[model samples]
Target: MTGSNRPAVSSGWGNLLSGANLVRSLALSGGVALHAVNLYISTTILPSVVREIGGFDYYAWNTTLFVIASILGAALSSPLLARAGPRGSYVAAVLGFIAGTLVCAAANTMEIMLAGRFVQGFGGGILLALAYAMVRRVFAEPLWPRALALLSSMWGIATLLGPAVGGVFAELGFWRGAFLFLIPAASLVALASLFVLPPRVEKRTESKPLPIVQLALLTLAVFAASWGGMGANLSSTVVGMVTALGLVGLVIVTERKSRHRLLPAGKFELPTALGSLYMASALLAVTVTCTEIFLPLFLQELHGRSPMEAGYIAAVMSAGWTAAAIYGSGLKGDRRTSAVRAGPVLSLASMATLAAVMPWTGADGDWLPLALICTALVTGGAGVGLAYPHLSAMILHLAPQGEEDKAASSIMTVQLCATAFGAAIAGLAVNLAGASSTPDDMDAANAARWLFVTVAVAPITCLVVMNTVSFKGADHAS
Candidate 1:
């Protein structure tokens, strides 16, 4: 992957926003936004969901199963797009999403809702990856950066809207309506893709078969951890962690020998640049997921804040992430290196701050403590923002020739796996810290402390792991 094969950065956003490019960009970006928003919207609505559906024991499974299914979906995207072409794949994905959302909206039990979520994840994952996959397919080389930026912006847009939409519906005692709301927007994306996206995309013959065994192992790992957390017992938790770790080890071993690899070559070698970058990204994602999945619940349950307020506070981290990413993209040379190193440092500081402040009681009215919490969340997010793009770029720099696409797509898979594992581990920490106790009890406070403290290891370790990967020769262009 030389610099010439790389897509040129757009001189301005002007070309991407006019004529056919505008519509194509919108169709791709809209799909990503829909997927991203759906991810967070469920977080806001899950408490209401559990209340209505009686799935308190399976709370973490919401994210766990969805993410696992997403890994499958993302893995299948290349082949699906090849066989179905852009239009066919887009329509199919949208239909799957719509059907799943309908099932969720109509579900009467947690089991039924989770089933719906699986279908939605399968579809949403395709849509998310497709947004990136289509960038080279649909746009001129010079416009790639603006196209990529537009797609990236969707996550930020989702952050702003997802929680608010879910919170509004939850507050109104119409949590089901939140799922329903996604259906129409998705339908519009389908319609837009039908007209706007090229009917036929060039299909690659090198599409690999799905690594079913590896996927199964990854799924089992997540299931083990989630099941352990649900057990809410020390023995079960430890057993589950060990089992999950065992499965993960099998995944690594299998990836090394598999014909179709889930990760790029040499990723298993930790001391190498590619290996270190992948590890750093995975660890960063784990830390981020811990905060995203559980923070709102903590704020609401512990501080007596309204659902809307708690949701917004949780969004503070995402706000920081989006802002810093955009700000960091313009950086170069020494500043970029500084930002990369500063990321984990800030992340560690935020987690430590959260451990101290999150466990406290009766400070809700002070406003100062709440402000501090938001600042901590933002700083933690900022840390990831500063480094993520650089880490991503380094992956491209190190990807084995002819395997760049696999390498790029695998980044999402690695991140999703980390998220699933993180959520399960966070659940375990919460349970161990006494999440079963009432929110006002000391046990619940202990749970908050444990959750933040445990997740902080991800960043602390990330700092050390990333330091070995020298990014001095990175291609900073799109």
Candidate 2:
């Protein structure tokens, strides 16, 4: 049945959650877990695959395209749910996601793969928005927080399994295997729909056109950020750069000057502390994600570690993050402060440790490089979990009343942009490091040393930024 067939609103969360509602949340969770796993698996596997395919220049474009497409996809979900109803809309998204995954598996070139990622991002983005939309429209407001928290937990599961799944397949020549998980996962979502999701509802519709031009502008901004690391010698890169600048200019002008705005109007001023916090999260994400991209390749080529070993280290990082998140909530005010402050320090230590102690070759010295690498990874992960959740909450609190949605969206946008920047920077740095003739073990160590040293600078800058700014006067409202 279509959305026109059901009612608009339903009973309280207590009623829905009392009996079968638990299972319903679980159903959504299952889909989220599958989605998160897909994201991580791809992140880990794609770097190596790109080496095989030989297309480093396009990395930013690929990620940027997906981010912009996803934003549009999320925006579209509101209307689609109103028109097609929840069940139809959700099922359609999953099918589209599945088809996109298939295209990724079959893609024979960079262009094709990028197209697949765009489609996959579009579908998955809608699926994500739909999860939130359902909770908003159907579940009682009181239960909403718990519902969202449960959805977030899936990302934790992804942190653990994504690398493992991606690494195993990379070893087995199964780049396509990553998508296999999605196939059954999609089917399971369909099956659970009969039991878990709320009854359908018909919403009023408007004839306003979809925001394609604005979206295209967003796409251009993303592309520019991704390609900015590369110089303007190439036409495509130049175009990408200009588009990003123009789009950003438009976003700023509209946000401050226009009565109608895309971001929450008061985001820049209402909670200055929160704005800093939000930006900090994005910067941290950039630092960490770049580390993730380079660390694997660095291990494989620099220290001669196997894919499995690199993956295990990645798992170690996740384990540390999980531990920190679990414990971070338990600490007192001062302890929380220490932990929060420790974020930048620990991140800096991680980079400095890698730069100083790294073994360019297995014969570098008597000391074991792997041991130090493990310590760094653990420290880095713990720091991130401590800082990120607080940052997110702070930003949301800082937003104007009823602007939480924009705040949340902005968080994702900043994060996506940061991650893209990190990847590009790492790619450029490593590429340059490798440019000279093959260096000896110590020389290779120097290259990595420089790279890690460069990475360490960001947190130090962040720490300074934090201290110089005082938050004593701002009114923090979440």
Candidate 3:
């Protein structure tokens, strides 16, 4: 999404945060924060979970299943909002999340925990997609940018608060309690939403049926990759990954021809801006998932860091992403274009640096190398922060007249699908490199290296896609 030459629309925090808008703002943003906080908390507690539940091999499946379910949830949001309206939709999402968290808190086995995560992801995805969709309906057009900013700020808040809560619980040896804590937070959001959000509006035929077949194919692809990694030998692993890749190809071809398309028109066509934007966004998201799903483990295992310390260190990436997104929102013309081009380079460099540095077991107590790792994490996040909003804005701007809402909501669908695939692929890489079969420290280090090195290709490919985007007429419309 190019933000090169659009005329500025006046929107300020004051206008967005005042009067009736205040309650509306809270309901929408609170849902986003709840989802984000749950994500960070789950990340922090997962290492402890593997230690207790004995599912080290299924580590990435946690994220893969959750993200896959989220794709289904995001895909259904438009129809749900249309039928259920804002208040009904909000309450339903909260209830679903509550049910999932309860299962997570009480689970005694890894399979049960994964099931709970899938349910939670489905609920959270609806909330996320709905929040974005509601921005246009709930706020004055001038205040959209500010409303979006307010929503994004929730992630930064989660980066601070979620880790603190999870770290405290992890340190106290009560990681299960962390999942339970989210129940009350979600309940509070539900109460606030029921009170503040408007009643059910009449249903319209504006939204189409959910693309269930496409979603099923996507899910099968991720499941195949993840299930392959659980095999006893490398041949099975290779077959699984190859099958997943093949299914991905089928999804692309099918999506282009489907009546209910998963992405906007021309998404599979790379030379055009929309296709390139979708590709870059999905690839960058995939690259980042490798870090999110495994970085805490690497820090704790390889660096001998405490749970609290590792959680915060991992959060540095998200903090950098949040800060840079806010900063990049104001860029114009050449600066904006430059940031877009530079983003993939930053991501590529960061992943490559991690590959080289993470394999050194001696990096444990060395502050110099640790600081460099932190720098790489932040730089990797900065790449995403710089380009995401701009890319999203372009998608919304370029959508055909009747398909505008679908296009807006599909952003999350695309990102979530990429995340699901990335997590599975990361699982495959580590499993093949021998993370699951051995407890040797060197084996874990080698797996980390393999994971980072393999994922670097995503960002490298993204750079090529970004370079091909034509921003000529993009600014003219917006």
Candidate 4:
């Protein structure tokens, strides 16, 4: 794949008109929606199921194990897709997913249920990353943006409807019913995938072992993020956080010295096109994933709303995301860059408003809880919707020649990790707030406030890097 082969609208028909493109698009879109609904449904059931199964003693592992497996699966996607190709990979993932579903459907013990969720997450992570990577190879350049937008839109819709849909099923005593039906959905997607995804080009630029060390670093980072949510102490959490940073540093050094770089050689040495793309993508994912993780909990716990209400509120978030994504896609010039730049500020401000008003809507009852939640949802959701796909597209565009899949998978890995990070922070805040913490109110607002401060800080690093760093051949066009 030459530089010209990279996506930049060259066709009158665009890739969107092709038969294979449409089929793959639907398959990818549907597959993602299925997995998302499954997850949301499972989560809705968990809060209710804990009493029937056991107490909080074994509860945290439900999320913890799933996230850990997801990280590992995402890290392995490039390798898996490379070896299996899209057809074989999707088939194998779906089959594995079926097995996990069965485990959950028949789960008599909490351990078995958690294990099923872990495997489910692994399949989900691989499916998402590989699907994004497959888009570059299978579709035409000009149409990639629209295709990505479709994919992102799929996410917003799934998130909006998933919990509510799940709640309906869960309330019907069919929490397991969701996954039972998944067998057919996965089967259909697998069958359809074989017909659409293009064959691999079979090019060998360099054969390198998967970057095991960097993979370890990311795994550790994911662990720290999840562990922190388990209510580990400040000092221990701080150490875990630092360890994650250290692992990241080690990955940089290792990638710099190695022949085959996992995260792109340009991710090191900073300020080149590679670093810019990475920063933009990582930040975009950081905000969006964080928003999705917290919104459900916030609406349900803080506002005394049911899962259905929370799901409806989640749609508002999706509306902001979709509207902003559509707006960002058409804009030219600074509109593009500024949206990326301002994303963090908007996210931070929303968090600020959320923290300030949280007490008013606490368990004691104050003003209109529903209205305040909608406002918070719109602000943060819009900020994320505004930025995620645009940044994602830019990152994919900057991928090294012939390595678009790696770039996509790598970006998804960052997102998966960051999502767990944000959720971990939220989980920790809730646990530390203790049993007295009421659904309407809790003192954990201060902890939440501090975490928001950290989340807000994520993007400001881009500004610092832009000003302070230099690379051999990067030109900042804006």
Best of the candidates, lDDT: 1
In candidate 3, what are the lDDT values of residues 361-459, reduced to their tens digit? 563356876888899999998887777766666666666655555666777788877776677677667767754665453377888889898889889
Structural similarity to truth (TM-score) of each candidate:
0.89, 0.75, 0.87, 0.85
The predicted structure with the larger TM-score, 2 or 3, is 3
> Against the unseen true structure, what C-alpha lDDT does each candidate score?
0.78, 0.63, 0.77, 0.66
Candidate 2 local lDDT, 365-432, one digit each (tens): 63467788889888877777666655554454455654444454455555655566555555545545
RMSD of each: 3.0, 6.2, 3.8, 3.9
Order of models, best TM-score first: 1, 3, 4, 2
Badly placed stretches (over 4 Å) of model 2 are 1-32, 43-64, 71-92, 106-111, 127-156, 167-174, 190-214, 230-247, 269-271, 330-338, 359-367, 433-447, 464-478
Worst 10 residues of 2 by lDDT: 469-478
Question: Which 10-residue window of candidate 1 scores lowest in summed lDDT?
Answer: 1-10
- For model 4, how big is the CA root-mean-square deviation? 3.9
lDDT tens digits, residues 1-478, model 1? 2233545645356767888778888788888887888987898799899998798988867877788888787767766776777789888988998888899899999999999999999998888767766765676644544455566556666878998898889989999999999988998899889987767644356556877898789889978877776645678888988999999999999999998876678888888888888889778767666787778778887787786778778878877777777677556678878988888999999999999998775543677778789999999888887777667656655677666555656666777777777877787788767747444563767888999999999999998997787777544443
Supply candidate 4's per-residue lDDT for 183: 79
* Candidate 2 local Cα displacement, residue 44, angstroms: 5.4
Give residue 260's error in model 1 in angstroms: 2.0
lDDT of 2 at 312: 66
TM-score of 2: 0.75
Any idea how many clashes model 4 has?
Answer: 4
Order candidates by lDDT, high to low.
1, 3, 4, 2
